[model samples]
Target: MTEPMTADQARAVVYDAYTTGLPQAAAAKLLTGRATPAWVAHEYAALRRRGVSSMAGQQTLFDTEAAE
Candidate 1:
């Protein structure tokens, strides 16, 4: 059997899927092997709660102005 994915791995998958406009359920089924849409949604919520930024490292106008 395939090994379980770590939290970071799952987060990366979810993030990539989201950025690419792929459906969460489809991403779970195709990439995670065992994860469900609910789980992916939960992970995504947690990532947001933790303030994880986008892969592109984009900053908001507020952030840019604050830095200056």
Candidate 2:
């Protein structure tokens, strides 16, 4: 079995997928082991609420493992 991912890794994957305009379904497949697309969408919405729409914003949002 694959090792469980850290929250930081999950966040980064979600952030990158969203920023790159990946379809939610595609992201769901890509992240099946980590999170569902609905959950990814939820995180996307949260990031938008925080004004995190740019690459820099994504990095800042997920750069630190300590934050989670």
Candidate 3:
């Protein structure tokens, strides 16, 4: 049986998936992609820990990482 996810738990998972270099689109393709907007935002925030700033925007970070 599947367990229900809390808002906080969903956010943490989203953050982890994003930081691992998975595109938001791809992340969304997964069942968990339908997570709350707040979770997605939190995911972006977590990316900041990887030398990426949320204020810089997601596309910017993806392109920058690609170039590196």
Alpha carbon lDDT of each predicted model: 0.66, 0.76, 0.59
Off by over 4 Å in 3: 32-68
In model 3, state the lDDT of residue 20.
Answer: 64
- Residues 1-68, candidate 2, lDDT per residue (tens digit)? 77898878888887787776666677678788688777878888887799866465456667787587
Residue 14 in candidate 3, Cα distance off native in Å: 1.0
TM-score of each: 0.51, 0.65, 0.45
Between candidates 1 and 3, name the one with more favorable TM-score: 1
Ten-residue region with minimum lDDT total, candidate 2: 52-61
lDDT score, candidate 1, position 47: 60
Q: For residues 1-68, what per-residue lDDT tens digits would candidate 3 score against the true structure?
A: 67777766766566655656666655555535457455565566566667763334356656866797
True-structure lDDT of candidate 2:
0.76
Q: Candidate 2: misplaced stretches above 4 Å?
A: 54-68
Model 1 residue 56 lDDT score: 32
Lowest-scoring 10 consecutive residues by lDDT in candidate 1?
53-62
